[model samples]
Target chain A: MSKKRIIAVSMVLAMLLTGCGSTAATANGTEEAKVEQVGQDTTSAAEEKSSDGEVITLTWLNHYAEAGKQAWVQSVKEQFEAKYDNVVLNIETVDADSHKTILQTKLASDDAPTIFDLSSNADLQVYNEAGYLADLSDFECLANVDAGLLKEGQVDGKQVGIPIELSGYGIFYNVDMFNEYGLEEPTTLSELKNVCETLKANGITPFATPFAEAWAFSCYPRVLYDAVCWNNDGAFWEKLADRSLKFADCEDFKKQMQTVWDFHEYWGEDAFGTSWDSAQQIMANGEAAMIAHGSWAVDGITSYNPDINLGVFPMPVSEDPSECRMIKEPGQQLVLFNYQDERIMEAARNLYNLIYSQDCMRVYAEEAHQMPSVPGDYNILPALAEIVNYPAELSFSEAGLKRNDPEHEDVLFETMMNAYTGSTFDVNELVDALDTAFDNIKK
Target chain B: MRKIRISSLLYILLMLLAICIFIMPVALAVLTSFKSKPELAKSILSLPATWNLDNYKGAVERSDFLNSLKNTVAVVAPSVVIIVLCSSMSGYTVARHSRDSRALRLLDKVYLASLMIPFQILMIPVYKIYKSLHLLNTLHGMIFMLVGTSIAYSSFLYVGFVKGIPHEIEESAYMDGCSEFRCFWLITFPLLKAISATVAALHTMWLWNDFNIAVILLQKENVRTITIKQFYFFGKYTADYGMAFAAAILSMIPVVACFMFMQKYIVNGIVVGAVKS
Candidate 1:
């Protein structure tokens, strides 16, 4: 009756009506969208599915959230659903940063995904200890997978994770920029430093180290560690793990750090504030000529600039070029969960067998631009071809680090971040800190 | 008079600077949304060579803007309504009768204690409880959790505001033969409108942008809110900034409009509530 009351009532009415979504046959007229969210479960499809038959939802929590990977995953889901009409793959792809928290909560609860991805060896061990891993040691499809790659996912000598694909880290350089300056891919430590100096003199930034990102510490900095020790057949790691080696004793390790400290000068203002995304954009825009990251970065880089020409070479961390090798490791692994329901577990198995097949993995290798863990003839990214095909003596597999306790790699990443991030860089302090950290890890 | 004018001028200048500081990021997001990735990489502060609507188009397609908007509205609207209705009554009873009522006194203490516990602490337990109830990934559970977590703070605000009101307003209605419920609704409720609007507006913004509760509770793709939908734009190593900013700019519109509409009530409610009974 009153003006104030009338207005309040109408606002509530409007909110309620809007909240109760009125379905309209809305469509963007006649043009396909370039960037679209894929794998949306339509209500109509769900209804149609239930109307005719029983279709179970197999939940999967994936870590790949980028557009290029999502598109490939969307196709994979569709193909799987079409092939197996009784099961709908309820795939949820969260960004890698927050995926862990969501996943830990879900995995602990009754709502855990039947299948999930773990980014690190430490994660595999933790989840395996929690009794979440569904003893995939007997999984039949794994017969075709490389034993060495499969070992990367093994925890306590028990096969838990099914290695899906692998990605490698290298010194990514802009080929066009390198060609413009007449600089070849540097092989030795001296040549790499020389390239940085020349690029700086020519008013081009040589490296866009995304030191602001905690994960970036694992990319280029770890490559430095691997370069010094990778050639010794991981004897340095074995001794270090056994507390027999001090980081200070390795002269090459100090040389690598000194090289890093030199390269640190090439990073311009806000260097520590540079994010992985900003670093890639800077490299793509030709603001920076080089970034040391991995095979996974190619899609993101090329998406930003379609015409950008890129190439990867081994990070020259040692004076002896032969000792400097690119670091390629198994990426995320898909581990089956221990489920009680027979129907759900069967569906999970069907999905697993389908995905691990060469036909499905080809999409991952070709589109996602990473090497499949399974033995398959797939074309590697042209930019990464040199590093992937680098002469055996000049390249190292991350599976070599598998000799050391899997958890040591995580400690090394944190220690390197601490050492590199300090205002004062000291080789002795860095090595001592690393030695102490390894000692602290539970044997 | 001259001194006062000079002081006023200084205050105005200070206010403008503060406004700019607050507005700059939003302005940057808007500008970035209109630029291509190359242009954005060139300079985050520079104007675009072309006012490209393509990013907005891409974001609309990529974020499922319409469905997420519908879901956000569904969760936020009902949660705000419940929070306002429940908090107002609890606040009124606690303010008016807590001295004589033992149950209300205990509840007030419980709510006051609950406010100190952060949502991050309750995230796992709440998730587990919801899973048992088969409420995970449902709008029903999402609304319930949002209201449950928010009611404590909203009631505290109402309790503060309700205590400031004179008890004479309700007494007069009671003297005229009005029942307690009718008297409170027709008489005291109108007087409490300012705080209610404030509560509704604050909760709308908070509930709309709520990530912690919604993220854990609403994991399904179709049930995702705009905040969750926008999260997929970022990857571990890279992000599509142009499209993400576009989604941010678009999503901010409803929130901004709601805040502006209730701006008067929010300021008045806070100022009134800050005064002692």
Candidate 2:
């Protein structure tokens, strides 16, 4: 052979040998399946186990602030491990915003985690419909969960995931700031307007709304949708789900938009630029008098200033008091995947039982500053526990009610926000656009 | 004279305006990095209230900036050397021998054809091959892949430059009892310096700032490059904007520094390579 041919053949041989060596190393060192698949199997197996001595590793993925809080994850993991010596709990934290994309990619690759948290009911429905989540209908631990919370996890008569907590959003006010201005929490839409006028007159911003984060604008429409359209027959949620109702057509939605527009004057000069976290901090630091957010902000507020007196009130966007609805959605869920192994199923069931038990719920409520799904007289932080029984109008997120229709929810919310932001298009036009998007998806 | 003076003044004004416009985004990013998160959120484009180093400190800590910088250099340096050496030698042989051999001409055509294939289409197959070889997460593996992908194009350029060089130089050296390898290296290699420098600079930038390959191949935290580190700084819902910007600025520093130091070589080399090719 010529020198060139010899060199070429030698190079090819070397590359082939190197490739074989690495493949053998990877086969030996790494887990047999991808990381996500391992998570799924482990979760399913843990659910099947009856008793915990088998030492099943359960991975919990979430994007909550507490997820990144080393102290919180370690504490929860330690508590669970201590209680159930046989089941080892591993926490895989991801950012909340990025979790959906990551989860979708993993599921496509069949590498989904055995246990992952879903932020919206719509997401739970999507996963349940796709058979990605295991049905927990017969799990006794769910017996004490609130019917509403349980309903959030159900898709087509099947309970596919477990609800861990519940949260509500209205208007959380700084009591000290309110007292300084001698203002009372508005009980009616007119009173709310008057309060804003009064605060503006005193040279203080009445509300701090961050429109930059589109979700922040969601609070106004969510409460109004509940107050005006929701009925005891569940026609409100059903109409929304079926696209039989147009938010702009509803007089209540128009009134709510008016209220939102009126309050725009009091949102301060740079309201459009303020971010959700920055707005929260502004409220916590007394830079703003009130912020419209969920009960989740309680811990953050107290942490910002231990002595800052905080008060909560339902958003009274409706002229009729009886029609007012506080916006809410299901908290995170503990889901199980169907596993054939009897032992694995039993182990997972036992783990779920531990998670839902009164003891675990109490720890979750107190430490996490969250409302437990289970019925319990748990000692929660004073501010948070007090709001648990607060008589604010309640409305579930439309996203939760139409969990299977993510495309619809995205359109509805996007259109609603566009209208609220002074888009020149009429509500009918926006609704028509949504209908087109939904129809296209259905086709 | 008056019209010429006015044209020169207009040109200067336009140049200044272009520079300002080009530098605006970089200036905003640097200013925003110095601001606190609250300040950043409040006015992303405004001047910072206080110039703070906290964001930079946080970015360095979170991104492991120094480690990524080191890994980036480790990948780029050797890859540059291997590409420059291999492409130049191969280009010389191909250009010199193609005049006499049909096989050399065919090889030249193959190399040219390889350049037309998109990098994205090659990524998965390359990754699978690398994975099978256990080269997925190693700096050496990355260097090997970079060299493999870059060699053909670099060699194409080198071949063109070598073809332009007078063959009489190599012939005279061969007549002096020098071996083929010695004649080529001692005579043609020095003459190929400009093209070599151009290839080296381009590959250095490509390998140093590359995100896609590094992300797919490197799973281990210790081996991640600077771009991967920047990406990992942002999470699903929450982004450490300050740190993201700071990390971005930091990642550009080494490349910028390298470019500044070699600016003269880069310009002259590319010009020479382009003219000869």
| C-alpha RMSD of each candidate structure in angstroms | 10.4, 7.9
Model 1, TM vs. native: 0.88
Cα RMSD, model 1: 10.4
Each prediction's DockQ against the real complex: 0.24, 0.09
Q: Considering summed lDDT, which 10 consecutive residues are worst modelled in model 2 chain B?
A: B231-240
Candidate 2 lDDT over A1-443, as tens digits, reads 59989999999999788544331112111222232332333333233245533556665655543423334455667777887767676554444544554444434333345567765666665556556677789988888787767877877788877788877777788887778878897878788888888777877677877667776766645555454555333465456556566544566555555666656667856776776767766775666777777676666656445666888777785566665565555677777754555655666677777777887677677666678888699887665655667553454443235433445666666766666566243555555665566556556
- Mind giving the per-residue lDDT tens digits that candidate 2 earns over B1-277? 9999999999999999999999999998898788776565456688888888998998898667899889988899999999999999999999889989989999999998998986654554465566457686699998887888889999988887888889788888888889999988888899987788778878888888886566555645688788777754553334556778888888888777777777777777666656654
Report the lDDT tens digits of candidate 1 across residue range A252-327.
7777776777678777567778988788788878989888887867777877786889898888876777777777
Which CAPRI tier for candidate 2? incorrect
**Maximum-lDDT candidate:** 1
Q: What is the lDDT of residue A423 in candidate 1?
A: 75
Off by over 4 Å in 1: A1-54, A230-242, A340-343, A375-380, A403-424, A436-443, B1-12
Residue pairs of candidate 1 with colliding backbone atoms: none
